[model samples]
Target: MSSDLWSFALNVYARPGVEDACLRLQTAGANVCLLLCGLWLEQRAVTCDEQRVSLLRTLTEPWDAEVVQPLRTLRMQWKTRAVDDAVLKGMREQIKSHELEAERALLSRLEGVAQAWARNAAGSTTWLEELAGAAASPNRDALQVLRVAATGT
Candidate 1:
C-alpha cells in the first residue's frame, strides 16, 4: 500500500462495496475520515493501540466536525438546486472540491500522526474495530463489509 494517506484512502475507497459500506458506517456515526486513516494504518502494519487511536481522534474530530462535515452538508443540501440552476451547480461542484480537499488535509494529518507507528510487523483490525466503537455496534453488518474491504479478507 502507498505511504501517502490520500492515495491510500482513494485506493481503499475505490474498492467494490467500500463506498457503500463507508456510507453505512458513517450513518452509524463513524467518522469516515478516521475510518479511512485506520484502514491506511492497517495496510502499513502499524501497531494500533489506545494512545495512537486517541491521538488520531484528537487530530481528526474537530476538523471533521467543523470543516469537512459542514462542507459536505452544504454540498448535499445543494443537490436539488444544482440540478436546476447552472450557477448553483457550479457552486455545488466547487463545494464538493473543497470537501475533497478538506478530507485530503485530514488524511495528511492522520499520516503525520501515524508516522512513528509505521512499518511494524504486527498489525490487527482491532484499531479499526475500536475506532468504530459502540455507535457502530448496531451497524455491525455494514462495519463487517468495510472490514472485509479494508483487509481484503
Candidate 2:
C-alpha cells in the first residue's frame, strides 16, 4: 500500500467494484470518508475496535459535513449549467478539486489517528461492518460486495 493517503485512496478506489460499492454505501447515508478510512486502516492491518471507530468518526464527521459535502453539492448543482458555460465549467472543476483536497485532508487526519494502531496482523472485514453500522439505511448486500472488493474475502 502507498504511504501517502491520497495515493492509497486512488489505488483502492480504482479496484474493481469499489467505486460502485462506495456509491451504494454513500447513497445509503454512509460517510464515504469514514468508509475509505476504514479501508485504509484495514489495509494497514490496524486493529479495528470501537474506540478507533469512535475516534475516526469524531474527527471526520464534522469535516465531511462542513467541507466535503457542501463542495460536492455545489459541484453537482453546477453540472447542468457548467455544460453550457465554459467559465462555469472551470469553476465547477475547481470546486471538484477542492472537494477532493478536502477528502485527502480527511484521509490524512485518519491516518494520523491510526498510526499507533498499525500492526502485522492480517486485515479483516470487521472494520467495514462496524463503520457501516451507523449508516442510516445501509444495504447489507452492497456492504458485503464492498467487503469482498476491498478485502478479497
Candidate 3:
C-alpha cells in the first residue's frame, strides 16, 4: 500500500507551515524542488497519479503530510456547480479571485527563482544556460497562456 514519491512528498510538504518547515527539513536533507512543488500543490490544489509521482521519485525522497484535508475541501469547492444566475455569478467571481491569487503566487515564485539564477550566474556558463531554460520553462509558459486566455485581452 505504499504510495509513489510525489504522493509521499505531497503527504509531507503540503502540511501547514511546511514552507517555513523547509529550513529544518533542508538541514535534514530534503530536496528543494520537492519543497517548492509541495508548496505549489498546496496553493493550487494540483494532484498527481502514482505514475506521475514515480517519475519525480528520483529527484527527491519521500515525506509525509500532517494536514492535507483543507486541500480536499478546496478541491470539492472547485468541483461545485452553479445552477442559477446569482449562484453562477458568485461562483464566477470566486473562481476569478482564486485564479488571480494562484497566478500571482506562482509568478512571484517563478520570478524569485529566475532572479536568483540570474544574479549568481556569473562565469557558470552551463548553470546560466540551465537557469535561462528554467526562466522560460514550459510550466511558466503554460501559465502565461492560461492567464491570457482567462483575461481575453
Candidate 4:
C-alpha cells in the first residue's frame, strides 16, 4: 500500500466494497477526506487525541463546506437534468472531475499537517471512529469496511 494520503486513499478506495462504504459514510455526514486521513494516520501509528482530532476537523470542515460541498451540490443537481441534455451532461462531468480534484487537494493538505506528527510504536489510534463521531455507530459496518481495506486485514 502507498504511504502518502492521496495514493493510499486511491489504493484503499479501489478495494471491493470500499467505495460503497465511503459513500455510505459520506452520506451519513462524515467527511470522506478526513476518514481517509484518519486511516492514513492510524496506519502510521500516530496517536489519536482530542487536540489532534480537533485540529483535523478545523482544517477540513471549512474547506469541505466552502469548496467540496458546493461542487458536489452542483454535480448532484445536474444529475436528472443532465441526462436529457448533452451540454448539461458535459458540464456535470467537468464539475465531477473538479470535485475529485478538490478532494485530492484536501487530502494533500491533510498529509502536510499529519506528516509532522510523530508515530509511536505503542500508540493506539482511533482516528476513523473519532473523526466519524456520531456517524460512526450508524455507519459502523461501512467504517469497518474502510478499516479492513485500509489495513488489508
Candidate 5:
C-alpha cells in the first residue's frame, strides 16, 4: 500500500476482486469511503477503538449523506435512461465524476483526521471488520475478499 490514504485506496481498490467486493458492501449499506479508510488505517497499524470509529463516522456521515449520496443517486437514477438519451448520458457521466470527487475529498478528510493517531507494535486488523460491522453478517464473503486483498493475507 501507499503512505497516503488516497494513494493506498487507489492501489487496493484496483486489486482483483476488490471493486466487486466493495460494490457488494456498498449495496449492503457500508460506506466504501469509510471502509477504504479502515484499510488505510489498518495498513498503518493504527489501533482501533470506539472513539476513533465514532470520530470517523462523525466526520463521514454528513459528507456522505450530503455530498456523495446525492450525486450517486442522481447518477444511478439516470443509469438506464442515460443509455438512450445522449444529453442525460452526458449529465449522468458528470454526476459520476462529481460523485468520485466527493469521495476523494472525503477520503482526504479521513486521512487528515486519522493521521494524528498512533500506530501499534503489531499492525491492527480490526479496522475493516469494525467499520463493516453492520454489513459483516450479510456480506461475510464479500468482506473477506476485501480483507484478503487489502491485507494480502
Candidate 6:
C-alpha cells in the first residue's frame, strides 16, 4: 500500500471498534509482522471476508508465525554443541541480536499504526480497549490509554 494509505489505515484500525477486525485478521493467516498493514486497513474501516480474516489470524499466531518459526530457523542455522565459554558467549550475543532485530521489525510496523492513534487527542473508551487488545505484551501505552478510558479523565 502507498505510504499515505498505509498511514490512514493504521489510524482507522487502531480505533476503539476494531477488535473484531483484528481478530478476524488474526484468524485469516496474516502475520503479526504485517500488523501495521492490518491496522492501516482497519483504520480505513476496510472489512475482510470471513475466509480472509481467518487466514490472517492463522498467520499471526505464535505457533504459526512469530516465535516458533524464528526459533526453528535459528535451530537450523546453528549447531548445538558443547562449546567453550567464549564461543557460547558469542553465540548468545548472536541470538540476542537476532531476537532484537525481529522485535524491532515487529514493533516498527505496529508503531506505524499506533503512532497515529497516539497522536489523537480524543478517542472513545472502546478505542482504547481495542488498542489494548490489539497491542502485544508489554503494551504500556495501551494500558495507559485504558486507564484514561476507565477514569474518563
Clashes of each: 0, 0, 4, 0, 0, 22
Q: How many backbone clashes does candidate 4 have?
A: 0
Q: What is the TM-score of each predicted model, taking all chains together? A: 0.91, 0.87, 0.27, 0.96, 0.95, 0.33
* lDDT assessment of candidate 4: 0.92
The positional error of residue 17 in candidate 5, measured at the CA in angstroms, is: 0.9
Candidate RMSDs in Å, in order, are 1.8, 2.4, 16.3, 1.2, 1.5, 10.7
| Candidate with the larger TM-score of 3 and 4 | 4
> Candidate 1: which stretches are off by over 4 Å?
151-153
Worst 10 residues of 1 by lDDT: 144-153
Q: Give the winner by TM-score.
A: 4
lDDT of 2 at 35: 79
Query: Whose lDDT is greatest here?
Result: 4
lDDT (Cα, tens digit) per residue for candidate 6, span 30-148: 34335543444343344434443444444435533665467535644554541445675577567767764664455454444334433233423233223324453444343343233
Worst 10 residues of 3 by lDDT: 123-132
Which lDDT tens digits does candidate 4 get at residues 1-153? 587899999999899999999999998899999999999888888999999899999999999999999999999999999999999999999999999999999999999988999999976558999999988999989988998998872
Model 2 residue 88 CA deviation in Å: 0.7
The residue pairs in collision within model 3 are: 11-64, 11-65, 12-64, 12-65
Per-residue lDDT over 36-98 for candidate 2, one digit per residue giving the tens place of the 0 to 100 score: 777767777777888888998899889999999999999999999999999999999999999
Give model 5's TM-score versus the native structure. 0.95
The superposed Cα distance between candidate 6 and the true structure at residue 42, in angstroms, equals 18
Error of 5 at 42 (Å): 0.9
lDDT of 3 by residue, 6-104 (tens): 333344444444444444443444334443443333223333334433444332232112122233235446554643456665766676666435433
